[model samples]
Target chain A: MSEKPYVSVENISKWYPYKGDKLINHEKKFIKANDDINLSIQKGEILGVIGESGCGKSTLGKLLTRLETPTAGDCLINGVSTKELIKNDMKAFRRSVQIIFQNPFDTFTPRDTIEQILLRPLKNHNIGNSKEERRKLCIERLEEGGLVPGEDIMKRYPHELSGGQLQRISIIRAMLLDPEFIVADEPVSMLDVSVRAEIINMLLDLAKLHNTAVMFISHDIALTRYISDNIAVMYLGKVVEYGKADEVVNNPGHPYTKALISNCASIDPDDEREEISITGEPPTPLDPGPGCYFAPRCFMACEKCLKEYPDKKNLSDTHWITCMNAE
Target chain B: MKNNRLTIAAQAVKSNRQLMAGCIGVLALLVLMIAAPLISTEDPTIYGPDVLNGLGENGHILGTNHLGQDVYSMIIYGVRTSVKVAVISAMISGILGVLIGGAAGFLGGKVDVIISEIINVFMMLPTFFLILLIVALFGNSLTNVMIVIGITTWPGNAKLMRAQALSLRERVFVKSAEAMGETKRQILFKYIIPNGIFPVIANTTLGMANAILTEAGLSFLGLGDPSIISWGQMIYAGKQYITSAWWICAFSGIAIIIAVLIFYMLGDGLNKVMDPRYNKRRA
Candidate 1:
């Protein structure tokens, strides 16, 4: 990882209110999808955010891409705050940061063929001066994204292609604009496992080739570690641990992080030792109490851990943990 | 690739036998209707006892009306009036309904509420009675009939289109477009209207047949334009001589049935072609 960071997320939080019978009573409850998330991505580095379902990993990805703005605090792209950047340079910011969605089927409009999809971003950003040049550039980019020739795919509708091909096309579209930062939220999650590695490899190569900063969000810790230079582990809307992927995998500090790493069956099945198992689902984020969000799922939950939110503790020169026992 | 799409449409056309037969029958009738002015030797209104002459006349193939005018010519002239009013009015209703419904459905919220309220108010009135009152007050001209049908027919199409648009508005692609910074007009025209308004258009074409038939019924009840020699006018003319001459009314009824069947068939074929579910299931 480089010394200088390309993107800095400083104490960001996001909440979505529940709409139900509670509304009739004039009561509002919010889902704390992201809580005080602070992280940074170095220039030309891939930072992977790994977590369980409903753990706010996807929400944080959306916040980074400006699909959904943070409720509090701010993310700084380079040196300018995201809120200020949006006012003066919204188009540039959107062009600079692109996102790859999980479901490739919904990524493009059904009426559009592959060519139209590729041409849309190019035309929107005024990347190509003419149609012929745009067409050539699209084919070239598709080839770089591992789609051969590309015109055959261009003439076809999305329904005619397999999940893998569609996903590759989506990736090609994002890369076509040559964005500086990318937030790929489970880009390969919907595809078959047999083709997952190919996509991950392609993403890694593209990141290197384009020098794009990426925040890869996924539930699979092993996959994230495979492509990511840095890793951030989230639990119940809080980053429990983050650092170099290899370091976090080898010496996980937080109890929540330890369970997540161990839970991955791919990492040392024969090294079965006495393990920590926290039962039950995570607590509802609506009106979450002042304590470690992971406290409910931690075996080492103390009284103080239950009553007070733990301050982010530095674990190493590059790692930080929001756990009470990070020391 | 283009050939494949052609073959698909061809297959659809082949499979729908009823639609094909109806279309052929309507085509034959349309040609006959258009050719009536040239084919008929007698004027529709010129009176002569010799014209009522029966089925095997020297010139009148379909026989003649009570006024001794050729039923064939009267039916032909009626075709022009009935078709002109119905087609014009159906087109008017279709364009207006699609616009009103599509905008309301796509815009949603307060716009939806207001448009829906207007549609609801129109729908609550007895449609036939409204048509009758309008025709009664406006003096039953072909133009007045067209106006009445156009104004009354729109509410149903608008309501249907609004419902369709409302559902399409919730699709993920629409949300994705919003995230991508697509304008509202682009979304409406490109996505919402294209996907939502096809059924309304198909339904309107089918509804035209019904509109024409309804106008014929009103004319039979002495409510249609007295000057235009419509199919319903021939029926009303033959009503007094019901026992003596049944061909005038019977054959005119056939013309109306054939026209209606043709539209229904076209609507059915278009629906089968346009409906996404049918394509998905069959493919």
Candidate 2:
């Protein structure tokens, strides 16, 4: 890890008002999308966030990118608070950070051709002086993104291109501004298995080329482990475990993290490992009871685990787990 | 690129007989309107000594009205009036509705609520009567009539545009644009409007048809500008003399019907051609 973090998420929490039921209005309810998240990424480091579908992994990405303001605390980029930077200079903040969404099909405007989509960020940020220069830059970026003979694909609309092709274009769009920090929210989850590795490798290569810090968010733990330098395992809007990717994956400290890792299909033919399957589904985020959010579904739950939320226990200098019995 | 759209439109028009017929009728009327002055032997509004001249008599091909103005020339000039009013009112209303409603839908939140409330208020009132009252109070000038019609008829289009904008605003591309640090104006015009404009274009064609019909109705009620001679005005001028000079009312009424029908067909054709759902099925 670098001496100074490129991106810092400091106890940030995002709570959305729950308005599902109209009759019961006495107590204001909120869906705690992201609760007290604290993580950082060094320059050129990939921090993978692995979780279930509604674990607020995407929400944390949104917060880090400044797409959504945190309800409490703040996220800092290069030591400057995102909220303050956004208020002070939104364009500068935007140019500094970019996001790659999961759905490549939905990322580009239907009206815009691939060229137009790529040129938008360059034009907005005034990357190139002239239109020709911008066009050249776009073609160059497309080539770098593994699209050879870029001119052929330039005129094609989003619908004309395959999902994998569009995903490449999206990556090029994010890298267009030469953004320092990138929040890739399940960037390859929507892609086919055949093209997934290619896209991932391309993303990693591009991030390395730019020396860009990245937050790789995904539900696929194995995929996240392959690309990430460090990993944070989240459950019900809280990070249950945080450590080096290989360390955490090999020796998961938290019960939730252990179950999550075990759930991923292993590759070895002869290795037989019993999967740890938790029974009950994760509770709704709205008005979570006074306990660890995972306590309801945890196999190793006890009186203390069900009564109070656990604090972060340092298993090592770098590895931190938020379960009472993890240590 | 524009040629591609044109080709698609041509293909769509060729495939549909009603659209083809509508195009022919509209084109023929447009040609007549353009050639009105060159084609007419005498001024349409000029009064002559020979009043209520029958068809094909004394150089009056379609006969003269009660005031002895040639009905053929009047009908030709009436096309100009009706087309002008329809085009102007449609342009004004279409632009106004798209701007207000597109902004409301794209911006959403409080702006949507406020604009939606205004649209609701406009929709709740009897639009025709409100237009009549405004025109009466503002004085029945041609410009005033066009403006009133344009302003009064936007609520429906606005509501439609708002609905389009609302759905488009939720599109992932729109969110991506925002994430790219695009300004609201850029997102609205460059992204939202372009994608959401098809329905508005279809709505505008329909609105033009409505505007032409509304103008005719207003003119028939004697609220049209007297300086201008429209099909409705010609009908109003010849209504009392229906028993004596039947051609005066007959020809003008037929012209009005044909114009309205042509516009309706064009609007319907445009709706079918422009609808994305239809295009997807065709693809």
Q: What's the TM-score of every candidate structure?
A: 0.84, 0.96
lDDT of 1 at A276: 62
Poorest stretch of ten by lDDT in candidate 2 chain A: A19-28
What are the runs in model 2 whose C-alpha is more than 4 Å off?
A: B15-17, B38-41, B276-283
Highest lDDT against the true fold, candidate = 2
lDDT of 1 by residue, B204-259 (tens): 87877877788888889899888878887778778887787889889888888877
- Against the native chain B, each candidate's TM-score is 0.87, 0.95
Interface RMSD, model 1, angstroms: 2.5
TM-score for the A-chain in each candidate structure: 0.95, 0.97
Residue clash pairs of candidate 2: none
Residue B217 miss distance in model 2 (angstroms):
2.0
Q: List RMSD in Å for every model shown.
A: 3.9, 1.9
Q: Score each candidate by Cα lDDT.
A: 0.81, 0.88
